[model samples]
Target: MKAAFLVPVLAALWPAPALSDGVAGEFDYYILSLSWQPAWCRTTGDGRDAPECQNGSGRDFVVHGLWPQYERGWPDHCETRERDPSRRDTQAMGDLMAPGLALYQWRKHGRCSGLSAAGYYAALREAAEAVRTPAVFDDLPRDIALPPAVVEDAFIEANPGLTADGITVTCKAEALAEVRICLTRDLEPRACAPDARRDCARSRVLMERIR
Candidate 1:
């Protein structure tokens, strides 16, 4: 017999949490995942209508996904696959999200967040509105270089309550990629977990400006 090489895959055994009444309100805090707008504009072209990317407007960090996370692992897809959100809920998010993502984020991370769809959207909006963008990142130069810690410091300085322990900067191929900020369920700043801390291996990285 010829030798066989098989790769293993792990399937979710539990039903969608929403169907089983969801695991709402069980997480320790919220993860407001922000993505660098330039990266998306230059790479994915997914958020074609995002306010920051429209018609030569200044670029910025936009809401990537508002995640419902436990202090450690997170949850996903708690509702029935076909669950749909109201137009009202989606509209409330404004230009922070791309089309069709409000509902997708709700089902995947909201349901497991231990909050109703409405409540989840409310929190998402709250967290996004609360953070004041650092002046440095607001108007990115053509191509600037800085250490990850510098970016972290910028945010902590801009936001009244942010701390070094509460923000994590992640990169993609020497370009700024994402910033994960932790907040309490009530949208208060909290220390990010060790797992969420930025561990950039480089001394500095190049930040690409919006196209």
Candidate 2:
């Protein structure tokens, strides 16, 4: 009788598991964002003291994130049972993105991936590797002004399967900012969602020279 009473008391005292705001691993696709380091340095990183902005960092197009997306919207900060990545795990991604961004991406986007931290990062690496950066941007000797379409064309030309609708170029403060590419859940190139297909319309947007 005493043992039965204790069971009831314990059940009353224990906390219920927290409910996740968004379901994990249920997104329709992914958006792989690549940031132009020079443009970022000139516009934002100049104030943040980011290592990518330091002289000789030699970074051009750097991984921004691999975000899960819906056909109409996107998920963020979803709760998950998987353990958070350790410092070492975030640091390992420094070659592709900043350690701080890696941690933030894991908290905001990675949690919704349904995979454990290790699996999410591995998938991120694979997704980035699947896309090829246009070689024309490499060692660009001087700043140039061009339509955003030109940048998109360069990317589509470099990656055979990537089409006009599969990628979008974004500009910031009249400068080239990022190139966002849509991919299938399995990492194949695909047309972007209507919302994701909003390309920057800036004609003669400045693309800063590589630092």
Candidate 3:
């Protein structure tokens, strides 16, 4: 009887055989690829500063369910996970620009958890920044000056996480001249100098870019 009881106990203690090959692989990939933190991503409609990064978990579902995976499907719906460490590092560094600690948490937990994908991407970016290496700033043409309103629109288009009124980009040249594009500090008026504003017009900044 003791042997019988012990046998049952041993069976219980023994790990259950992993699911079948197909199921096992699917679950493993799903777990690794899925974005567990849905709340981490920010939505376009809601004017949230530092919108949560789209939860990548939804993309895993699409991949599993014979759905099409596209960039359009990611924002406000799914998070993107970069399988490449270099790409992941790029994203994690971007996460540092978020306005609040919530993003910091998202960046932190996203990498540490079993759920992979975007989290891993973020982790890589974070790791890259920690190294304190200088990023090579790719130079662009300085002559191109878009209209103030257009520049404002472009700024908003570039960073969906900032407030709806990213920049009060007036069409009038004089008004445009007064309009300063701040970096990172979006809401603060007079935050950017003339030179910085011109630079903002040229590039897609993670924080606030004005015209």
Identify the candidate with maximal TM-score: 2
Tens-place lDDT per residue, model 2, 1-211, is: 0000000111111112233246778788988877777776776666777655676666677777788888877777888899999999988887676667777778878988888888889988898887888888876788988899999999899998999999988877688777899999898999999888767777767888776
Give TM per candidate.
Answer: 0.79, 0.86, 0.18
Off by over 4 Å in 1: 1-22, 46-55, 79-83
Error of 1 at 208 (Å): 1.7
Each candidate's lDDT (Cα)? Answer: 0.66, 0.75, 0.24
Candidate 1 lands at a TM-score of 0.79
Q: After superposition, how far is residue 1 of candidate 2 from its true place, in Å?
A: 68
Q: Who wins the lDDT comparison?
A: 2
How well is each residue in 58-114 modelled by candidate 3, as lDDT tens digits? 210000000111111111112335232344443343433212222332333232233
Which portions of model 2 miss their true places by more than 4 Å?
1-21, 48-50
Query: What does the lDDT come to for candidate 3?
Result: 0.24
Quote the lDDT for 148 in model 2. 92
Candidate 3 Cα RMSD after full superposition onto the native fold (Å) = 22.2
